[model samples]
Target: MTVQTTPAGTPMPDTMEPEDDDVKIIADIDEPWLPSILTIETGLPTMGVALGAGLLGVSVNSGRGPLVAFMIGLFSAVLVFLAVIDWKTYRLPDAIVLPLYPALGLAVAAGVAVGAITPTAALTAVISMTAVFVILWLIAFFTGGLGFGDVKLGGLLALVCGLESGYAAALGALILPMILGGLVALPLLFAGRRKHEFAFGPYMVAGALLILLLPNVLVPISRGSLFH
Candidate 1:
């Protein structure tokens, strides 16, 4: 069996969880509305940034109407920032990620307010987020294919997707990201970098965005715009 090792040739951890820092700071500060923001990369890869911008455009053009579009467009911007940070650092800070749950919760509520999403769909979003978290946590426990950051992000994605579609679609979203990740992994394996750890967050983001934007992509094709 091929053993994966780091640059120093040490066996990779069973779970590729980021090593915790030892010199932890202790403080008594007000638990303000936010957690401490972790250090993130200011410089991002151009391709990833461009893709993010494209996704933002797609979100705006999703044809879900104004209020829904604004919410998702905001989310797309946030995802872009997270995706680039994760792509560079392989870390998604709790300060950034955890806020998204409540934000999406608010989005669902607003969507209901605007009659963009049904009350039943809002309930299903809750169910879908819970189900996605449990399933992702199990996968992390077993295969270590995902990090806690990815798990949280997956739940957020599930909530948004469930609000738009339904429970089954949200659950079905689990597969595409893995398939996408595997496809990316293949090149590294072939290039003899099989042991190299790459970020999984971008793939997860891409998968969710694809599902969310598919109707927009499909409608034009169906109407024979490209074919014509």
Candidate 2:
């Protein structure tokens, strides 16, 4: 048996294996992958995104009309891709997220031009994105539980939700992801899984998808006494 020494010069058993949770956390921190490799390996997820986008396009048209639905479908596809990448690597690459800002801007602009959303609505979307991003950043800074990637993803989801419904939808986007992630984690906790961390991106994406599909659930609140 080999002995290992800690940085503090304490001796430890090298035969001790890391816990499953520890292995996952270590991989999250240390694993790296090339973009090309990720693209090739994520075919199933990509196909899933495509199918989701198709269904979303149909749903959006039925609910909100065809003009805005296209953009929402497109955005949903992007979110799905981002969610998969974050789940696999625990990182959000700027190569994907950065270019998306301008693309989203264009999509919003197009929506306004087509009368799918008003200029006021577009401004609200921007405000929602900024607010959600700052709130998550503050949470991460204080609690050290979330990362910048999650913050950025939250901002993007808020933007989409706000555009689709209203500020209330944005609020739902902010709250729902954490609730969904917590629900998944609860079972593991009850089973005695300690110090485990899971990806928040997928839940965030799921929340955004839910908001898009069920905007009426939030739209009523957006116009209710609480918001008004």
Candidate 3:
């Protein structure tokens, strides 16, 4: 049998994987339009995410400045991209998450070099990394709901958030995942589903970002009995 041709004049091979169509169509879509739509639809949340991530990073670094905040925002965007890819594939490949640890150390060192991160803050950042990693791993083991990737990712985040907010950073990191999971799960549960599987990183990112940007609200609420 002969293959069919798309309206755009591209011929579809008979044995092409089904996913190829979506990939092709997505690429064929205009590039400029994506940024435009992302800004339009996700504008507020994107900005919030960026600001939050940066603030937490700066706080841990003990360096608060527009530049640091901008870096946080940029990294937040990258985190979003990584999380989305992982959610789709269910694989948080170390190729993306691993290097971030040492790179974060460098960023912290850079902040120190520039006098953004004081010696005290730098020390805190180091301690935060170890503490968050151990804590998250324990939670993951007991619940069986979290993965090694989550624990690893949480460590990297601690350098940014834990150093910044101290104990608050840890609180935000832990509570946000449960909240996001609940938000996603409650609807499903009400519909009578008992157990379900979700990627969960996005919600963690959301909680972290919220704590970074709007801790005044999120921290209090997270500590409250919102779930009850």
Candidate closest to the true structure, highest lDDT: 2
Off by over 4 Å in 2: 1-42, 62-65, 189-194, 217-228
Lowest summed lDDT window (length 10), candidate 1: 30-39
Sequence-dependent TM-score of model 1: 0.67
Best by TM-score: 2
Rank list by lDDT: 2, 1, 3
Question: Which residue pairs of candidate 1 clash?
Answer: none
lDDT of 1 by residue, 103-174 (tens): 778878888898887898889878888888899999998988789889988888888767655533353347
lDDT of prediction 1: 0.69
Report RMSD for candidate 2.
Answer: 8.5
TM-score of each: 0.67, 0.72, 0.64
Measured with C-alpha atoms, the lDDT of residue 13 in candidate 3 is 63
- Position 156, candidate 1: lDDT: 85
**lDDT of the structure predicted as candidate 3:** 0.66
TM-score-sorted candidate list, best first: 2, 1, 3
Q: lDDT at 173 for candidate 1?
A: 49
